[model samples]
Target: MCTSSVCNHTPKPFALHKSSSVEEYLEKNKQWSQSITNETPNLFSDYNSKGQQPHTLFIGCGDSRYNESIFNVKPGEIFGLQTVGNNLNLNDETIISTLEFTVLVLGIEKIAIVGHTDCGAVNACFDDSVYETLPKNLKNYLKPVYENIKKIKDVHKDDIPPIDKKQLSLENVKEQAKKLLSVDFIKEKFENNTLQILPMIYNVENGLVETIDL
Candidate 1:
């Protein structure tokens, strides 16, 4: 059956569907803008006129599950920076510069270091096989999470599973919050009672945050 009669085959269409579709996002944004503007006529105009004067620099996980709405944050409220495992480093220029701009320039008074439950990046710390499999840049980016987990384990190796993850996450927030104080500007501001750091963990299973008692 060697047929050359055009094969009579319908080729699959080439299109960007699912999360990869920028067109989908643009359309949704257009609809949302219309709906929101209809509800709060002056919202966008106020945002444009006032610019952003966010109160908190919310350092959070890069997990798509969490966002402003999840935290009950209105637009232009929290200056958020999302990182893998919510890892913070002074060396990461993006983190440092955001801190400098928010704290020094914008006079943001609060800092929220937040970690979440069942984080893929945090889980990878225990998977011995994951280290070599990740792309070089991704592996390097995850170094801080790993190092922090290691430090936690070294002190509390007997802890297991949910307990381990919970402590690790809470401690992660605590440690990241502490690291900000190491920054000269942050230390000065904190010492002067101008900046407050709140360490928290969002339980994905419960959708509730547990604040670290520090």
Candidate 2:
């Protein structure tokens, strides 16, 4: 089990000067620790203290608006992995390691691949030309997203219709879910109904999440 100090839920904002960004974060963290402990002093205190056993695994975008706090869950209630586009690349060691630990070790049964409206990564993917100006690392990092969009268009061949970013974002959510289910252990568990995976989309304008039926 993890302590409230180990994971924060509600946050208090602090002033940040150009040179004091780090200092402000640390100060706010201190304040948060003091406040939450006062409110729920015994929160998560009676657990067995055996490492985290979060109920769900969330694959969310790295955007600040889409965070663990959005679900209104306790600090360790949701184990999360946030990426620029909430993508899943089987070749990535970090992704693979997290999957192995969560599914095989911690035994987390539920997973959600969440996307959101007004996503910069999905927008960049929709407009491939933007990639030309990006730095090498960022451009390479988003390559797969572009490739997926390309494949979607290529299927049309003759005249590719304009694709809506929101629709595309939804497609990306579905694609990531499919990618997660592609993993051997995850797929086997899913097939046997031991594991559950769902696709979700977060509406930035409304600050709500909708489940993708696919």
- Expressed as tens digits, the lDDT of each residue in 39-99 for candidate 1 is 7788789883689888888889999778545677667788889988788878889999999
Decoy 1 TM-score against native: 0.80
Model 2 bad stretches (over 4 Å): 1-18, 48-50, 128-139, 153-162
Mind giving the per-residue lDDT tens digits that candidate 2 earns over 168-208? 88878887888888899999999999899978899998899
Listed per model in order, the count of residue pairs whose N, CA or C atoms clash below 3 Å is 0, 0
TM-score, cand. 2? 0.80
| Candidate 1 residue pairs that clash | none
